[model samples]
Target: MIEHKPLRLLRHLAWIPAIWIAWELLHYEQYKLLGNPGSVFLFTVLTDWLGFHGYEKAMRLGVGAMEIAASILVLIPRTQGFGGLFAMGVMSGAIFFHTVSPLGIDPYSDGGVLFKEACLTWAAGLLVAVLRRDQLVALFNRIAGRDAAVPA
Candidate 1:
């Protein structure tokens, strides 16, 4: 059995908040830097998808809080698995948004912002995989045993 030490787990957990803060800081001026047209278009899409129209300011704040809560949940041993899954969904949505927006116009156009987003998406997936490796292994074992027990 793979042993997860508390210190090691905490170290990995620390990356969750650290990374989110870094991303927010780095992209604080994303709407302005990328252009207002694109910003308005993306925001509209977000509002429609999240059903948070007429309260854009509150929506943004809520999203940030949700991200923080998810990260914190992922740090707790008992909730880490579910939290990781939630984080993965959030990251995946981010990746999809970037891909389908003007953000994907050109890799070189936005100072490699799309590239950074892609990297972050992959990082989130990798982190979740690492944190849940034992669960994944167990799942695989169960499937493999079932296959072996079946008659040809």
Candidate 2:
């Protein structure tokens, strides 16, 4: 009995975005996001608009931590599905911010590189979700205590 090799490769690819995001976010023991006034202002506006007041630093830290955790999870075969789902959620928020907030598609004037990365990461997450669907189902079954036979 052999497993599908391409799906395994796709599942592994999901970790790439998580690692990149975590590096950009949690580098140097500090949150490196919003380095400029425009980025900060955009975040302030988005935070206020989203109705999450008085905890912007905490929010950034929390989100970064989530990315780091997802990065770790996706690298491990057993937790890849959970990690991919979590990373997708983070990427979705990013895409939404870049789309609707003052963040815009070209924030940081990086020729829309950040936005492109977010889109690519989102797409990779989708690939992981579809390629590892069975693993996700097995995870859910285990969580539900149904004792289903999960793949090795």
Scored by lDDT, the top model is: 2
Can you write out model 2's per-residue Cα lDDT over 70-135, one digit (the tens) per residue?
667766667766777877898899898889886689866879987887777777666666666778
How well is each residue in 14-53 modelled by candidate 1, as lDDT tens digits? 4574455335433544453444565455555666666667
Give one clash count per candidate, in the order shown.
0, 0
- Model 1, position 110, has a per-residue lDDT of 64
Write down the lDDT of every candidate, Cα atoms only. 0.53, 0.68
RMSD of candidate 1 to the truth, in angstroms, is 8.9
**Per-model TM-score versus the true fold:** 0.48, 0.73
Which pairs, if any, clash in model 1?
A: none
Q: Where does model 1 exceed 4 Å of error?
A: 1-55, 103-110, 135-152
The residue-level lDDT of candidate 2 at 87 comes to: 73
RMSD of 2: 3.5
